[model samples]
Target: MPRARPPPPPPRRMEAPPLPGFSEEQFRAACRELDQPAPAAGGPWQLLVESMGVRIYRLYDEQSGLYEYKIFGGLADCPPKLCADVYMDLDFRKQWDQYVKELHEKIYDGEKVIYWEVKYPFPLSNRDYVYIRECREMDVDGRKIWVVLAQSVSVPQCPEKPGIVRVKNYKQSLAIESDGKTGSKVYMYYFDNPGGMIPSWLVNWAAKSGVPTFLKDMQKACCNYSKNT
Candidate 1:
């Protein structure tokens, strides 16, 4: 009998492509922030709202003259893995996030980048952002933690558009883990300065109302995620 080919060398296992600009240090820093206690009241951090099992707070940055927000909450019916999946699902985002006028991913200089254009109320121009983001899961003190972090980056190919305002300064960090039962606990830090002269009132409204609305929408989306996918 012809020599039987040794079982074809075990098929090579494929590995996930590395994130182009991923930084372990940055991811760890975000995790640390998530572990910190909530900012004290009567200080720079002002409580915005506490309802529906969520708390939102904002702090002013003198350098940027903008507000940065910190939010934490529990999702009663959503698991950590499901929450992360729903958040990262760009295709599904378009179907659910009404404010997403345009969103997509592209490659530039061998790095994957995300571009998002958000709708502003009438009379105000739309805003767009180009940023790089990454996510990872880890075990901390026997508890599983999931983190997603993002920051705006300058990309030569993606320049300012005529009508849309470009958000030059943006950063976001999100951490999710078990709620000790059947749900997930969440934490987030976010800031962005939409270029141009936007009224302070409008900005405040967007922040205060937008955050809770987004969480509610996300929860609803999570409920439908399995069926939709």
Candidate 2:
């Protein structure tokens, strides 16, 4: 009989502290900024900030996309012990800063990241008002996940409606990987509409309507296709 394969090796743990290079003050500052509220009033369009403003502090490992530390939310309000493991590691901060810089640069060209649709369910009749927004991909966990950082602006409501409304939306997607020779996996996380903004009405309508159906259909299409091996 063939010898049994050796047991898979145990998972190795990192010994570093969180965000080594950055000081507690720095982390606190970043968190504070993230928690700050957006401007109340704005120009022609009402502006509200999106939740994508997370100050992610992660520690990368040998594993393709493993994360050692992930701190989300403002420092003051965030769980004090969230990333206690490596919250003080020096090398981690160096890498974190580099990643943040790259992320900022990616935001400028977000139109190329993820595609968005102006109208929900289906495009408009003339399709003239349709807009496609792109999502920026960031390395999260051990792989590239689409991340969108958006700021909101107040906009006029319906001509009949009296007051403006505040809405929050996010849009991001990830292309699951398949064997390089075979191509990619079909599963995708369509985060939000263009610019990552969704009106409250859209959210309610989507849950009641058939957006979930669209998502499932997309997934099936990807899963059913066979590579041209």
Model 1 worst lDDT window (10 residues)? 13-22
Q: After aligning candidate 2 to the native by TM-score, how far in Å is the CA of 160 from where it should be?
A: 23
Candidate 2: regions farther than 4 A off: 1-128, 141-143, 147-206, 225-229
lDDT (0 to 1) per candidate: 0.86, 0.27
Residue pairs in candidate 1 whose N, alpha carbon or C atoms collide under 3 angstroms: none
What lDDT, from 0 to 1, does candidate 1 have? 0.86
State the displacement of the C-alpha of residue 61, model 2, in Å, after optimal TM-score superposition.
42
lDDT of 2 by residue, 1-229 (tens): 9999999999997533221122334323323322232322342222221232322222334433322222222222212122221122223323322211111111222221211112233332110111123223333344432222222222222121222221233322222222223332222222222223445565444333333343333333333222211
Tens digit per residue, CA lDDT, model 1, 60-143:
899988889999887878999999999999999999999999999998868889999999988999999999998899677777
Best by TM-score: 1
